[model samples]
Target chain A: MIEFLQYHLPVLLIAIPLIAAPLAVLLSNRYIVQSLALAVCWTTFGLAIWMVAIVNQSGPVSYELGGWAPPYGIEYRVDQLNSFVMMFVSGLGAMVLTYSPYSLKAEIPLSQHYLFYPMYLLCMTGLMGMCVTGDLFNVFVFLEISSLSTYALISLGRTRRAPLAAFQYLIMGTIGATFLLIGIGLLYQMTGTLNMADIAEQLEAQRLVNDGQWAGSRTMLVAFAFLTVGLCIKMAVFPLHTWLPNAYAYAPSVVTAFVAATATKVSVYAFIRVVFGIFTPQFAFELLPLDTALWSFSLVGIFLASIAAIFQQDVKRRLAYSSIAQIGYMLLGISMADVDGLSAGIVHMFNHALIKGGLFMVVGCFVLRLGSVQMDDWKGAGRTMPWTSFAWVLGGLGLIGVPVTCGFISKWLLLTSAIHNELYPVAILMLISSLLAVVYVWQIVEVLYFEEPSEKAKHATEVPPLMLLTTYTVVGANIVFGVWTTYSAGLATKAAKALLEGGSL
Target chain B: MFVSIFILTLLVVTAITIARIGDLWAAVMFTGIFSFLGACWMLILDAPDVAFTEAAVGAGVSTFLMLGTLALAGKTEKPTTSSSVVPLFVVAVTGAALIYGTLDMPHFGDPNSPVQTRIEPSFMEKSQSDMHGLPNVVTALLASYRGYDTLGETAVIFTAGIAVILILRRSNDGFKSNDVFNSQSNSRKGSQ
Candidate 1:
C-alpha cells in the first residue's frame, strides 16, 4: 500500500480534487457537499504531507499519466520546491474549508453553499495541478479551470459589485491566460515539446551549439517576454494589479482568504519555474538584464503599493494592497539571482501565504460578528471580540515583520541578501517598505483599540469556536514556522540551491 | 490560393464589421458569420474536422445562445465615450510583435520544423500499432495518449456551465430541484 501510494500520489493529489469537484455538485445537499469538500481537502493535505515525506526520502518524483512516458504524455513532477509549495497550499485549503461553513453562513447565501464547495474544490484542483504538472500546456488547462471557478466564486459575494469585480477579473485573467498560451505555443514551435525539462534540455543544447548565443534569438526572447508578462499580470505585479483590490475586497471572506493566499503565490511559482527551470539563470539574468528590470519593478511596486495600502478605508482592500507589496518583496529576492536571495524569496512566499491567509481569516471573523469590513465599523472590536482581534494583532505583527514572527525571518533574509550582494539601496528601500507596512497595520490597531465602539462593535461578540480555532491554527503557524526554521527555511534553502544548480542536486 | 485569399479577406472584413456595428443583434450575427468564415478557411487548410466542429459549435450553437440572450437583454450596445486611439495603438503593437516573432519561424509546410520532425512521427506510428491502426491519428492521440488533457478540457466546460447557472439563477428561489421541476411542469400545463 505504501509503495503504491508512493508511486501514484502525485497524480492522485490532483485527480482526487478534480473528480471530487463535480461530485460535490452532484451530491448537491449543502451539508453533504460541505462535508465532502472538507474530507477531500483534508485528504489532499494529508497526501501532500505524505508526498513531502516521500520527496524528502527520494530526491524527486515524476509520474506519467495513462502509462505513457514523459515528453509524450503529461507528467506530474514534484521536486523539493513544488512539494514544499503543495504542502502549504493544500494545508491552507484544508484550513479554509474548516473555516468556510460558519463564515459562509454570514456572508454567502445559503442556497449557493453547495455550488461554492464545487468551485472551491475546482480551484484547489487547478492550483495543485499547476504545482505538480511538468507539461506546459497542462498548466494552461489548469489555469483556466482555476480561473473560471475563481470568477464564479468571487461573483457569489453578498454585494452587487461582486459580479462587476468578477467580470473585470475575468477580462484581465483571460488576457493573461491567452498571453501564456501564446508563449507556450511559441516555445513548442521552437522546441517541439510541452515537457518543461525537455524544453530546457533542448534550449541548453541549442545554446551550446550556438556558442551560448542561442538565447539571443528573437523567437526565444519574444517567448520569454510573453511568458513573464503573462505571469506578472497573474501575479498582480504593480501596474497590472488594478483587478486585485476590488476582487479581494468583494469576494466572500473565505474566498478572499484562499485566493489571496494561493493564487498569486502559485503564479510566482510558475514564474520561477519558467525563468530558472526552463530558461537558464544565465539566460534570464546575465543575458537579458532581467534582474535589473525585476528589481526596479520590485522597488517601485513596494513603495507605491504600500502607500496605496495606507490610504485604503476598506480593511480588505488595504490588505489586498499590502499583499501586492509583499509580492514585490518576493520579486526583489528573485531579482538577486543568488542562493540566499532565491531562498529568501521562497521563504517569504511561504511566510506571506500564512500571514496574509491568517489575517484574512481574522477579517472573516470580524465580518461575521461586526457585519462590516470598514475601519470605522471595526472600532473597539478589540474590546468586544477579544480573541479575534488578538488574532489580527498577532497576524499584524507578522505583516510588520516584527522579530520572532514568520514575516521577520523572510524580511531578515531579504535584507541580509541585499546587503550581501552589495545592493544597499535595495536593502534600504525594503526597510522603508516594512515601515509602510507598520503604518497600515497601525491603522487597524488604532481603530480596534483606541477608538470608541461603533454600534456594531458594541454588539459584536467572539466568533464561533470552530472559526476561531482555524484562524488561530494559521496565525499560530506563523509563529511556529518563525521559530522552528528547520522546516520552512531549511526546505526553501535546499530548493533554491537545487533550482540555481540547474534544478538538480 | 485565390479562394484562400478571398476567404481570408472576408474573415477580416467580418471581424471588423462585428466590432463596428452598434446594434448588438447585428454584431452577434456578424460574429456568427465571422466564425463561419473561419471554419471555411480551416476547411481550405484541410482540417475538415476542426472546421466542422467550429461550424456546428461556434457558428451554430453560439449564435443560438446569442439570440436567446438578445431576447432576454437589450438588442443594442451602449456606446463608450472613451478614446479609441490607445486601444488601437495597443492592438497594432501586439500584432506587430506577433508578426516579428513569426518572421523567425520556419516556412509553412517545412518538414524540418520541430512540429513536423519531433514527436509527431512517433505519434503517427504509435497510433498505427497501438490502436489497431486507427485511421485518424488525432483521435487516437486525443483519446489515448493525452486523455488527461481532454478531461481537463471537459472540466473547463463543466466549470463554465456551473458558473452560468450559479450567476443566472435567482438565489431567492433557492436551487432545489422541486422548484425547477414545478416551474417546468407549470409551463407545460399552460401550453396544454
Candidate 2:
C-alpha cells in the first residue's frame, strides 16, 4: 500500500476530483454533492502534503503514466518548485471547498446547487493537473479545463449581467488558449518533443555552436515569444487584464473566491514553469529580454490597478481591481531573477491567495445577507455582524502589508531583494505600491468600521457558523504565519533554490 | 507545395469572403468551409490526428455552436457603413507581426529542418519496443507517451459540456432531458 501510494499519489490528486466531478453530476442531491466535493478536496490536499514530504525526502520523483519511459511518456514529475505549488493549490482547493457550501446555498439557486460542486471539482482537477504535469502540451489542455469550468461557474451568478460577463471571459479565455496551443505547437515543431525535460535538453544542446558562432535559431525565439505572450494573457498581466475585473466582480461569490485564489496563481505557475523549467533563465533573460518587459508591466500594473481600486463603489469590484495590482507585485518579484526574488514572488502569490480568498469570502457573506456589496450597503455592517467584519478587516490588513499579516512578510522579502539587487528605485516602487494598497484597503476599512449603522445594517446577522469558521481559518492563518514565517517562507525559499540551481541537490 | 499553395489561396479567399459577407449565417458557413479546407491541408501535410481534431472541432462543433448563438441572437446582421480604419489598422499591424515571425520558420515539408532532425527520430525508431508494439506510433505517443495530455483534453471537453449545460440548460426544468441541439420550442414542449 505504501509503495503504491508513493508511486501513484500525484495522479490520484487529479483523479480523485476528476472522478468525483462526474459522479456529482450524476447524483441530484445537493447535500450529497457538497459532501462529496468537500471530501475529495480534503483528500487531494492530504495527498499533496504527503507527496511533497516524500519528494523532499527523496529529491525529485519521476512517475511515468502507465509505465512509459521519459522522453516518450507523460511524466508526473514533482520537484521542490512544483511540489511547493502543488501544496498551495490543493490546500487552497480544500479550504475553499469547506467555505463553498454556505456561500453556494446563499448565492446559487436551489436547483443549480448540485451542478456547482461538479464544476468546482473539475476546476480543482484542472489546476492540480496543470501544476503537476511535466509536459508542455498537457499544460494547455489543463488550462482549457480550468478556463471552461471557470466561465460556467462565473455565469452562475444571480446578477442579470452574469451571462454576459461569462461570455466575455469565455471569448478572451478561448483566444488565450488558442494562442497558447499555437505556441506549444511551435515549440513541438522546433524541438519535436512535448516532454518539458526533453525540450529543455534539446534547447540546451541547440545552444552549442555549429562552428563556434551562436547556433540557436530565430524560430525558437519566436516560439518563446508566442508562449510568453499567450501566458501573459492567461495570467492577466497588465494590459492583457481587461477581461479579469468584470469576470471576478460579476461571478457568484463562491466562484470568485476559488478562482481568485487558485486560477491566476496556477497561471503564474505555468508561466514560470515554461520560462525557468523548460528554458534556462540565462536564455530567457539574456536572449529574450522578457524580464525588462515584465518589470515595466508590473510597475505600471501595480500603480494603475491600485488607483482603479481606490475609486470603486462596489466592494467586490474594488477587490477585483486590487487582485490585478497584487498580481503585479508577484510579477515584480519574479522579474528580479534571483533566488531571493523568486522566493518573494512564490511566497507573495501564496499569501495573496489566502488574503484574497478570505476577503472574497467576506464579500460573499455580505452579498448573502445584504444582497449587495456596495460600500453604501456596508454602512456599519461591522457593528451588526462583528465576526464577519472582523475577518474582513483581518483580510484587508493582509492585503495592506500590515506588520502582523502575511502580506507584510512577502513585501519585506521583496523589498530586501530589490535593495540587494541595487534596484533602489524598485525598492521605492514596492514601498509606494504598499501605500497604494493601504489606500484602497482603507476605503474598505472605513466603510466596515467607521460608518453609522444603516437600518439594514442593524438587522444584519452573522453568517452561519461553518462559513464564519472557514473564513477565519484563512484570515487567522495570515496573522499567525506573519508572526512565525518559518514553514511557508522556508518552502518558498527551497523552491527558489531548486529553480535557480536548476534542480534539487 | 503546389497542392498546399492552392489550398492556401482558397483559404485566403474564403477568409476574405467571410469578412465581406453581411449575412451572418453565410459567414458562419464560409468559416466552416475554411475549417474543412484547413483540415484537408493538415491531411496533405501528413498529420492525420490534427486533421481529425480540426475537422471535428473547427468544422463540426464550432459551426453547431455558432448556429445556436445565431438562433439566440437574431440571424440577420445589421449592415453598417461605418469607417473600417481602426479595424484595418489593427489587422495590418497584427498581420505584419505574424508575417515577420514566420520568416524564421523552415519552409513547408523540409526534411532537413531543425524540427524534423531532433527528438522525433528517437520516438519513431524506438516506438515498437518502447510503446509495447503499438501498431500506430501516434496513438502510442498520444495514449501512453502523452497520455496525461489526453486526460487533460478529456477534462477540457467535460468542462465544456458542464459549462454549456450550466449556462444554457435551465436546471431541473425537464427541458434539459431534451437534446442541447433541440430547438427552443422543442425544449419548451419537453418542459411542458
Candidate 3:
C-alpha cells in the first residue's frame, strides 16, 4: 500500500484538482463549491508534502502512465525541483481557495462565485502539470490549457475593464502559443522526436563525433528563437509585458493572487527546461550564445520594469509592473548559467510566489472591505484593517528583499552568483532594482498606513475571517521559509545540480 | 515542387481572407479555414500527430470558442478605420525576414540533411530499446522521455480553461444594479 501510494502520488496530486475542477462547475452550489475546492487543494497540498518526503528519501521518481515504459509512454517525473514547486503551487492554491469565498462575496457577483472555484482548480492543475511533465510537445499543449483558462479567469472581473483586459491577454497569449507551436514544429522537423531526454541524447551522440553539420542549421536556430520569444512573452519579460498590468489590475483579487503567484514562475521553469533539458547547456551557451542574450535582456527588463512600476497610481497595476521587475531578477539568475545562478533563479521562483501571493491576498482583503484598491481608497485603512494591513506591510518588506525574508535570500544568492561571475555591474544593477522595489512597495505602504481614512472608508471593517486567515498563512510561510531555508533552498540546489549535470547525476 | 506551390497559393488566399473579411463572424470562419489548410500542409509533411492536433484545436475547438464569444459579444464588427500602412509594412518586413531565415535551411524532405542523419539513425535503431515496447516514436517521446514538458503543456490548457471560467462567471449576489446600461439605451429608444 505504501509503495502503491508513493508510485501513484504524482497522478493523485494532479487528479484531485483536475477532477474537482469540473465537479465544482457541475455542483454549482456555492458552499459546496468552496468546500470541494478547498478539499481538493488541501488534498493535493498534502500529497505534495508526501511526495517531497518520498523524493527526498529515494531521489527522483518516474512513473509511466498505463504501465507504459519510456521512451514511449507518457511519464510523470518528480525530482527535488518539481516537488518543491508542487508544494508552493498546491499550497498557494489551497490558501487562495480558502480566501476566495470571502473575497468573492465582495468583489465577484453571486452567479460567478461557483465558477471561480472550478477555474481556480483548473489553473492549479495547469501549474502542477507544467512542473511534472517530461515531454516537449506536451508542454506546448499544457501551456495552451493554462493560457486559455487564465484568459477566462482574468475576464471574470466585475469591472467593465475586465473584458478588454482579457481580450488583450488573449491576443498576446495566442501569439505566444503560436510561437511555441511553430518552434516545436520546427524541432520536430529537425529531430523527429518530441522527448526532451531523447533529443538531448541524440544531440550528445552527434556532438561526440565531429558533427558541425547541424550545429548552426537554420531550422534549429529558428526553433531556439521561437522558444525563447514565446517563453519571454509568457514570463512577462520587459518588452513583451504590455498585457500584464491591465490584466493583473482588473482581474479579481483571487485570480490575481493565483496567477501572480504561479503563472510566470511556470514560464521560468519552461525556459529552464528548454535551455538545459532539450538543447543542453553547452549547445545553448556556446553554439547559440543564448546566455549572453538572456543576460542583456534580463538586465534591461529589470531596470525598465522597475522604472515603469514607480509611476502607477492603481495599487494592483503598480504591483503588476513590480512583478515584471521581479521576473527580471529570476531571468538574470538563469542567464548566469552557473550552479549558484540556477539555484538563485529557482529559489527566487518559489520565494517570489510566496511574497506576491501574500501581497495580492492582502490586496484582495482591502478590495473586499473598501470595494476599491486605488491608493486613495486605502487611506486610513491601516487603523481599521489592522491585521490585513500588517500582513501587507510584511509582504511588502519581503518584496523589497528585507533581511530575514525569502526575497532577500534569493536576491543574496543572485548577487553572489553575479559576483562569482565577476559581473560587478550586474550585481550593482540588482541592488538598484531592489531599491526600486522598495520605492513601489513603500508607495503602497504609505497609502495604507500613513494616510488618514476618508469618511467613506471609516466604516470599512476587517475582511472576512477566511481571507485574513489565508493571507496570514502565506505571510507566515514567507517568513518561515526565509528563516529556515534548509528544505526549500536545498531542494532548489539539488534541482539546479540535476539540471546543470544534464540529469546524469 | 508543384505541390508546395499549390499549398503556398492556398495559404496566401486564406491569409487575405482573414485580413480583409469585414464581418467578425466571417473573419472567424476564415481563420478556422486557415488553420485547416495549415493542418493539411502538416499532414503533407508527414506529421499526422501535429495535423491531428491542429485540426482539433485550431480548426474545431478554437472556431467553436470564437463563435461562442461572438454570440456573447456580437456577430457584427464595429466599423473603424485605421492606418493600413503600418500593417502592410509589418507584414512585408516579417515576410522578408522569414524568407531570409529559410534561405539557409535544408530543402524540404531532404533525406541526407544533418537533422535526418543525426536523429533518424537513433530513432530507427534505439527507440525500440529506449521505450521497450512503444511502436510510435513520436508517442514515446511525447509521453515518456520528455513527459515533463507534456505535463507543462497540459497545465497550460488547464490554466486557459480556468481563466475563461473565472472571467465569465457571475458573482454570487448577481449582476450589479448599474449593469443595466442597455436599459438606459432602451428607455431612450422608447422616448424617441
Candidate 4:
C-alpha cells in the first residue's frame, strides 16, 4: 500500500480534487461541502509535500497511465521543479479554502456558498492537472477546462462590474487559448507527434544529423510566436495586462486571492516549460533569440507596471498592477536563462504566491469588517483590526522585499543572478522596482495606521477567527520561508539545474 | 479538393454572417454556424478528435454560453458610432505580417519536410510497440509524456470555472420583483 501510494501519488493528488469538486456539488449542503473541499485540499497538499519528499529522495518519478510506456502512453513526470510548484499551489489552495467560508459569507450569498467550495476545488484540480500533465494537446484540453471554469468563477462576483470584467477576461482568455491551440496544432502538424519527449528526441536527432535547423523551421517559429504571445496575455505581462486589474478588483475577495496567488504563476511555469523543456536552451537562445526579447519586455514591464500601480486608488487594483510588476522580476530572472537566474525566477514564483495570497486574504478580511477595500475605508484599521492589519503590513513588507521576508530572499537571489551575469543595469532596475513596491505598500500602510479612523470603523472588530487564522498561517509561512531558505531555494536550484542541463522530457 | 473548397466557402459565409448580423440572437446563431463549419473543415482535414472537440465545445457549449450572456446583458446590439480606421490599419498590418511570415513555411503535406521525416517516422513506426496496448498515440501522449502540462491546463479550467461562479452568481433577494423602471416610479411617488 505504501509503495503504491508513493508511486501513484501524482495522479491521486489531481484526482482527489477533481472527484471532490463534483462530489461537493452533489452534497449541496454549505457546511458539509466546504468541509469536504477543505479536507480534499488539505489532503492534496499533504500528498504534494510527500511527493516532493519522495522526489528529493529519488530523482524524478515517472508514472505511466494504465500501464502504458512513455512516448506511447500519456506519462505523468514529476521532477523537483513541478513538485515544488505543486506544493506551493496546493498548500496555498488549502489555506485559501480554509479562509473561504468566512470571506464568502460576507461577499457571496448564502445559497451561492454551496457552489463556491466545489468550483474552487475544480479550479485547484485544473491547476494541478496543468502542472503535472506531460502531453502537448492535453495541455490545451486542461487549459480550456481551467479557463472555462475561471471565467465562471470570476463572473460569480457580486458586484455589477463582475460580468463586464469576466467578459473581458473571457474574450482575452479565449484568444489566448486559441493562439495556444494554433501553436500546438502547428507543432503537431510538423512533428506528427503530440508526445513532448518524442518531439525532444526527434529534434535532438535532427540537430545532430541535419545542418538545417528544425528550431528555425517556419512552423516552429510560428508556434513559438503564438505560444509566447498567448502565454504573455495569460501571465498579464505588461501591455497585455488590461483585463487583470478590473478582474481582480471586481472579483470576490476569495477568488481574487486564489487567482492572484496561483493563476499567473502557473502561466509563467508554462512559459518556462515551453522555452526550456520543449525547445532546448540552445534552440531557444540561438534560433528564437528569446532571451533578448524577454529581457527587454520584462524591463519595460517592471517600470511601467510600477508606475501604474502607484496611481491606483482601489487597494485591490493597486495590488493587481503591483502583481504585474512582480511578474517582471520573475521574467527578468528567466530571461537570464542561467541556472542561478532561472532558480531566482522559480523561487520568486513561490515567494510571490505566498505574499500575494496573504495580501489578498488580508484585503478580504478588511472587506469583511469595513465592507470595502477603498483606501479611505481602511483608515486606522490598524488600531481596530490589529492582527489583520499587521498581517497586511507584514505581507506588504514581503512584497517590498524587506529583509527577513520571503520576498527579500527572492530579490536577493535575483539580484545575485543579475550581478553574476554582469547586468548591473538590470540589477539596479530591480532595486528601483523594489522601491516602487515600497511606495505602493506604504500607501496602504499609511491608510491603515496613520490616517484617522472613520466613525464607522470605531465599531469595527477583527475579522472572524477563521479569516484571522488563514491570514496568520500564510503570514507565518512568509516569515518561515524567508528565514529558512533550505527547502524553497534548494528545490528551485535543482529545477533550474534540470532546465539548464536541458534534461530530456 | 472539392470538399476542402466547399468547407472553406461555407466557413467564410458563416463568418461574414456573424460579422454582419444586426440582432444579437442572429449573431449568436451565426457564430454557431461558423464554428460548425470550422468543425466540418477540421473533420475534412482528417482530425476527427479535434473536430469532435470543436463541435462539442465551440459550436455547442460556447453558443449556449453566449446566448446566456446575451440574456443577462440584454439582446440589443450596442449602436455603432463611426468607422474605425485605426483598427483597420492594425488588422491590415497584422494580417500582412502573418502572410509574409507563412511564405517561408514548408508546403502543406510535404513528406520530405524535416518535421515529417524526423518525428513522424518514429511515431508512425514505433508508437504501438512503445505503449504496448494503447492504440491512440495522441491519448498516450496526453496522459503520459506531457502529462504535466495537461495537469496545469486542467487547473486553468477549474480556476476559470470557479472564477466565473464567484463573479457572476447573483445574491439571493438582491433583486426585487419589480424592474428598475417600476421601482423608480414607486420611489418618485413616495418622495412626492
Q: In model 1, what is the error at residue A12, expressed in angstroms?
A: 0.6
Candidate 4: list runs displaced more than 4 Å: B39-43, B47-76, B82-86, B89-106, B111-192
Pairs clashing in candidate 2?
none
Chain B TM (all candidates): 0.85, 0.79, 0.81, 0.82
Per-residue CA lDDT of model 4 for A1-505, tens digit only, reads 9988887898998889888876887799988998898899999999999999998898888877666565545677888888888899999999988888867776667887777777777778777877887777766666666666676777766555666788899899888888888788766655666667776776666566666556436657777778888889999988788899989987888999999999889889888888888878777777768887887788898888888888887888899999999998889889888888899999999999999999999988888777776777678888998999899888999999988999998899889989999989888987887899988999889988898897646779988888898889998889998999999887899999987785645
Q: Write the per-residue lDDT of candidate 1 for residues A115-213, one digit (tens) a residue.
A: 889989999999988899999999999999999999999987766677889999999999999999999999988888999998898888878888877
Worst 10-residue lDDT window for candidate 2 chain A reads: A209-218
lDDT of 1 by residue, B1-192 (tens): 899999999999999898898999899899999989999999998788889989999999999999999998779888989999999998898878788888877777687887667786578887798889889878888998788899999999999989888888756443222211111122111112
Q: Cα RMSD (Å) per model?
A: 4.9, 4.6, 4.7, 4.7
Q: lDDT for every model?
A: 0.88, 0.82, 0.79, 0.80
List TM-score per model, in order: 0.95, 0.93, 0.87, 0.89
TM-score of chain B alone in model 3 = 0.81
- Residue range B82-101, candidate 4, lDDT tens digits: 88787789668756645654
Between prediction 1 and prediction 2, which has the larger DockQ? 2
| Winner on DockQ (1 vs 3) | 3
What is candidate 2's CAPRI-style docking category based on DockQ? acceptable
lDDT of 2 by residue, A283-322 (tens): 7787667788888889899999999999988788899889
Runs in model 3 deviating more than 4 A are: A211-216, B1-4, B21-106, B110-192
